[model samples]
Target: MYLLMMLSAAVVSYTATWGARYVGNRMELFSPIRSRDMHSTPVSRLGGLGIFAGFAVALLIASQSFFVKDIFRNNDAPWGILAGAAVIVAVGVADDLLDLRWWIKLIGQSAAALVVAVWGVRMTIIPFIPEPYVIDSDAVSIALTAGLIVTTMNAFNFIDGLDGLAAGVAIIGGTAFFLTAYWVHRTAILLDRSDLATLLTAVLVGACIGFLPHNWFPAKIFMGDSGAMLIGLIMASAGIVSTGQITSGLYDRANGIPTIIPILLPFAVLFLPLLDLGLAVVRRTALGRSPWSADRGHLHHKLLDIGYSHRSAVILMYLWTCVLAFGGLALAVFQWQVVMAVNLAAMTVMAGVTAWPYLRHKAPGLGPRSSAEEE
Candidate 1:
């Protein structure tokens, strides 16, 4: 059943990418080259439509299935997520076509977040709170959920600086979310898992894979704000449904530090983007600039300045994301002894690899490879 949903989304996304190749130019939806843009040439920027098409089709179809319907009946989260996604996608499309101001974009994001909250999808429980104050007030829960959605949307938006970077991260994070959520449903009997969240995550993974062929290095089309923001909302929605709908029973099941794993897994999966977002805000504010202002000081840019080629930098980040996300999953499922042993071995290997470069001889062109050289 899950495979069917993923494949359905993949097919839709693939078709959308192909169609965009021809129609995107005609629609005047190319992302213009800017001072901070990594690409020199204008590229089709509305690729998120393909992702949305694939996801919506699979979800709408699944919502009709007898088995899925049984799991999601009367669940407003699924419908609310879709509605919020639509709002974000519209904002992204408008931004891509009209170059909307930052405040305008924020307004759109806020509206979408509020819409999801109004649909009864707010985070009612504080996942890591101590036993005494586990539950939060209605106002606090709604505000935090909405804030999380908006922050995630922007986090992903800020990291869409390199070819395949945002899409790759989305795929990795979505996979982690799916695995962790599925494990929780299968293992944690006290909790009622949202089947819709699991299904949507699977579709998100499939959409990212389907879109990557066109978005990878030397890309044909960019997902633009539409795709990035849409993915952010999807990821945030998955997290909300998975961890936020907690019951007092869940608190009873979670004992001591073990309780934190469920909360930490989502943050670990999304660590890179959130980290980048935080650093960017701090860096911008420290320089007396707007936190929303764009710059070339991202981690990717630093990697390029240090010695890595564009593709190399992207691949390195991909490896880190996989490690962090899957490592978090391992912690959720495995014992502390096993996780510690594995982490120690992995750390040793990584340390050796890092030191090897310093021990090797330097050559004239052995520094950072240029773009033309990469070609």
Candidate 2:
């Protein structure tokens, strides 16, 4: 299933690249709003439309394929997801063409989230839980989901600051989600329901794969608002869907953590984007500015400031993403011994380099104490 899905996604992504180029060269929906030493002249910014097409088709095929027909036929999840996705895409398309106000975009995102909530698909906390873990608020659930949707969409959007940056990160995250979802599907099959989680995983992988060629280093086209918005929506949707699959009607205490693993799956998968958003907010707040205020303080911006090429910054971030991804995967699978061993090894290497005496001495007064003093 993974093989077929990847193959189809590659084809779709390659084709989408061409489609994006055609639209950029011909339609003139939107052009590069910002550029910083990008390789291509007047870089294409709305390439996301092509990625969305491939993503949609790829997911539909992966889910409704002959082997998984029953899963598709049984539930309204797919259709409901599609409706919500359509809303996000439209909102993004408008933003791409015309600079929509942030508030307008927020409203659109909330409306889309409300669409899902109305499908009897709202997130409900585990009722009757003891203190600390007890979060019992329907309004809070709604707000969290809406905010999460908006934040995820913008997290992907805002991180599109360097060439191939957002696309590469999306692939990393999609791959992580795919692995975790597949794990959930396997556990689900052992329990009862056939593994639709894997099908969703396959679709996500295919979508990212298809988009990467056009979006990789020296990108000929960009996965503009269309692609980023769609990517965020599906990823958010996949997280929700997998959570439902994993925690349905099976609450054995031992299996609970493993089952609820997908809840944290999306956050870990897209941690770079999420982290970027957080840092952006903090930086802005520290400067007594609005969170939406733009600046060159992003991690990518910092990498560029430090003399790394755009591609290098993107690749370096990708490496960290993979490390966190696989490490988190190990944790999810209950391999604490392996995870701990790997964690220790990582800290050792980090200590060797980051704590190197010579480097630290060269940049005087830049040790733990300085950092602590700053804090």
lDDT of 2 by residue, 230-348 (tens): 77767776665655544353322222344445565677777878888999899899999988766777877766665566777788777767766665665666656767689678756
- All models, RMSD in angstroms: 4.2, 6.1
**Model 1 alpha-carbon miss at residue 258, Å:** 3.6
Model 1 clash count equals 0
Error of 1 at 99 (Å): 1.6
- Measured against the true structure, the TM-scores of the candidates, in listed sequence, are 0.88, 0.82
Whole-model lDDT per candidate: 0.79, 0.66
Clashing pairs in 1: none
Highest-lDDT candidate: 1
By how many angstroms RMSD does model 1 differ from the true structure? Answer: 4.2
User: Candidate 1 residues 154-211, lDDT tens each?
Assistant: 9999888889999999888789878877766656564345465678789999988888
Runs of candidate 1 exceeding 4 Å displacement: 129-132, 188-194, 245-256, 344-375
